[model samples]
Target: MNGKRGMHYVGWKTLCKTKASGGLNFHSAVSRSGPLKARLSWRFLQNKDSLLYQVISAKYGNNLWDATNRRGSSIVSKILLEGAQ
Candidate 1:
């Protein structure tokens, strides 16, 4: 569809609009929700890694070698497995 004419179709117009209207984009008035979601997801991943590190150290002691890289690798592997599905 052409740039200006893309929104002409009721279906196309609705798809380019907001989630409340069944589109992928968030409401224009509260667009910060998208950025907020990214920030929160980043923070949650960091928190998960931190928590995993703490648990590994507490259970396995300082011998939990290469903890940060290992944790990241595990997450990557898990994602890869899921993606393969």
Candidate 2:
């Protein structure tokens, strides 16, 4: 900012480490997405009767949970199944 380029003194992943580990303690969005997707996948498994689950299943078919058949799935379906795998 301020017409200046930021210095690359350390990698972003390193800077995201915990403060106790000598980093800035910032959370990376890339690192956070895995757990979030996994949580959503877990919720989908636990709440099969939910409307979202029902809609997704109806659209994607029962093979939705099948790891090898992700032919033309939507982004949401892909994310959920990826976390499952």
Q: Pick the candidate with the highest lDDT.
A: 2
- Per-residue lDDT over 1-85 for candidate 2, one digit per residue giving the tens place of the 0 to 100 score: 7857877589887899899998999988987898899999999999989998999888878777773465676888889877787
Local accuracy of candidate 1 as per-residue lDDT tens digits, 21-79? 67876345344644655554455346756764455446546443333445554543333
TM-score of 2: 0.64
**Model 1 pairs whose backbones collide:** none
Which 10 consecutive residues of model 1 have the lowest summed lDDT?
76-85
After the best TM-score superposition of candidate 1, give how far the Cα of residue 49 lies from its true spot, in angstroms.
Answer: 6.9
Instruction: Give TM per candidate.
Output: 0.24, 0.64
- Measured on C-alpha atoms, candidate 2 has an lDDT of 0.84
Misplaced by over 4 Å in model 1 are 1-29, 49-85
Tell me the lDDT of model 2 at 16: 93
